[model samples]
Target chain A: MLILECPCCGVSGEETEFHAGGEAHLKRHSVGSTDDQFEEYLFMRENPHGVHFERWRHNNGCGKWFHAARCTTTLEVFGTYCAQTYEPPKEIKDAISARRPGWSWRNFS
Target chain B: MFEAVSALQGASFNAGIAEVRELGLRGMITLRGDLTDKKLIKAVKGIAGRIPEPRTVALKDDDGAAWMSPDELLLMVPHADVLSTIETLNASLKGTHFLAANVSDARAVFEVFGPHAREVMAKLAPVDFSPDAFKMGMFRRSRLAQVPAAFWMNEEDAFTVVCFRSVAEYMFDLLSIAAQAGSEVDAL
Candidate 1:
């Protein structure tokens, strides 16, 4: 029942219209990386109960992939942005921090 | 002489509330590039009347353009004019990174006409079909039931839907079922 808006085409649709792409902004470990780093890269994932960032595709709409910042507890969406960036934009981070103080996710706080 | 044939061979259905008719063959071009590029805009304007704004359509008679994405546009023209339109686009946008392909055969089009046309569309797609929300010239790309589809309102009582040709029968069935008699949701 989650209603998400595609930032690319500015169309809002139901969750059924989109495909969830799991976690977002994962760093890849290249060929020369250590076993621990590669294992962490492949296996480790953040399962935060509060604020989280994830990837979603507007599969039925514009067919563009975008990032969404939301809360796992209340299903409150902080914002959605284009997926072309390496990290969540500062405005989205600030918006999340404003609502949930002392919140930190990986390298972004 | 090669005879062109549509996927559904001109299917039509009357469900009391609306009339669903296959639009036969239509010329469609998938153009991808920078929408703001001057040459690209001019080339597309020549064919579709004008470049559509995001989530909108620019229509002039049988020719129109629907905004598919930030970098893509779906141009509609007469079936016989697809090849020539592509050639014109290629010549207009030479040396620029762009793509224009004939997708006329890849899609099936249907028109739903009646006073309750929006009701039929509202039953399947998860879109705001309220008169205030989905006005004329507004194009939407979304799923109709379980398959991918796109639609736009040509008039208050008419809607045009497009889906892959492989699912033309399915789309026709979906529309006909949604338009069945005594199944109106009069909410929007």
Candidate 2:
């Protein structure tokens, strides 16, 4: 049972109380974009073994969506932050980098 | 004029450890806005006596308010006062970006009263029902088995649960099963 804390409501609950909304920080490819870009936007996902960022909804609680940083292998959550950001917060990125040195995701290291 | 009816028409169950009864026709209003705004707080205070803290409730008699989220509060009043309460809130918060809607008929309420009432709640929700953790005034919105529900302690050995009217029977049955005789966890 993976436990996640919703930053919006500050409630820590099991995965059953929340809904996983796939990867986090995806740039949309709207009209006039190339078909490949659109397909990549819709289908491409990062399934990293460690230090992954994902979107989650506090489905049963606050009903607000937020971002979570955790390890896919160990399920060690680095942190959770508000969902209205384009990238993970600096503290979360620093926390991930402290544990996994020389690590990089998307643009942040 | 039209007649109003409650979801369950006052269904009740007794299972030795606890008694579950459908609380008929409660007035509920879903108010979404800046909880910290002076005008909003004053408007809510006029109805509930005070604004509730995070994940808590501020109640007085049949009227009170429960914090539902960062930007939402559930206002409780007498069934006959729902419309008037909303009108007052709207008039008070005219310039604010807020929403106050009457949700009385859209929901169902139940009461669990007994020595083991916390146990019955613990069985269904993924919450800490221990006395030290869940005290009076602390409200929680969580799942009751397969449905979304919110509950809070109203007395030392009693809890009030609220859920959508569509699942009133399901919630009642779930509570009944959880409070069934000889099915006690005896932990909390």
Candidate 3:
């Protein structure tokens, strides 16, 4: 019944066509060089309310992944943007890019 | 405007395929993008003159409806110029963050007109079919038998219902039911 606006498809379709991808901009922790440190970094989350980012998938239409921001209570989507272009907040981006004392994308990949 | 199909008179449906007998009345262009793209915004403004007002229909001089949003807008224009309009709008854009598509084939529309159109709508749609509740030239997303559709009344007694192509057959069935109900109600 709710007309969900798909950022990629450019149409207001039934919410059935879309699959909420959960919080959109969850940043991965920097590589922590050591095995124990990396494991801890891999599993952490701060599910905060009040202006949080979430991911949504256009499962029925374009088959693309995207991100959106919404109110936790009312489901008023404030903004939607492509996941590819998602620019995490400066603080989070910096924290992840720093790569701790010795971590990188290779360890997990 | 969808092509009017053979009406099943025994059923309660008034097919609006009559409206699409030629080309169609409304030419809908779908625009998708991140609202943050200034270039895209500027390009749309350059062509359309002004962006659609938020969550409302923005009508320019032409009989077009720009259903505005935080990210997407459906630009409805006179059906004849759909191809040209898409080209012009896309040409004006310098950025690659958005796509403007002429999806005339993807949707089937019903241009239901006449005095009893509202009566037929009541049975077809769940929302109040009153002129005051819907007003003229305003659209809302509703369903014709659980199918997603956009409905709006342009002039008094003239309503337009647009739905995706996949559900067109199902909608037509429901329209028949509503049309029959409309005639029955009129007799009373």
Per-structure clash totals for the candidates: 0, 0, 10
Expressed as tens digits, the lDDT of each residue in B42-120 for candidate 3 is: 7566546666554355556664555534567777776678888778767766457788888766776766666777876
A44 Cα displacement, candidate 1 (Å): 0.7
Question: What lDDT would each prediction earn against the true structure?
Answer: 0.93, 0.93, 0.59
Please give the fraction of native interface contacts (Cα pairs under 8 Å between A and B) kept by each candidate: 0.86, 0.79, 0.00
Candidate 2, residue B180: lDDT: 89
Candidate 2, B1-188: lDDT as tens digits: 99899999999999557999999999999999999999999999999999999999999899999999999999999999999999999999999999999999999999999999999999899998999999998999999999999999999989999999999999999999888888877898
In candidate 2, stretches whose alpha carbon ends up further than 4 angstroms from where it belongs are none
Give per-residue lDDT, candidate 3, residue A78. Answer: 49
**TM-scores for every candidate against the unseen true structure:** 0.97, 0.96, 0.53
- Index of the highest-DockQ prediction: 1
Poorest stretch of ten by lDDT in candidate 3 chain A: A100-109
Candidate 1 overall Cα lDDT vs. reference? 0.93
List candidate 1 segments past 4 Å from native: none
TM-score of chain B of each: 0.97, 0.98, 0.70
Q: TM-score: which is higher, 2 or 3?
A: 2
Fraction of true interface contacts that also occur in model 2: 0.79
Alpha carbon deviation, residue B50, candidate 1 (Å): 1.2
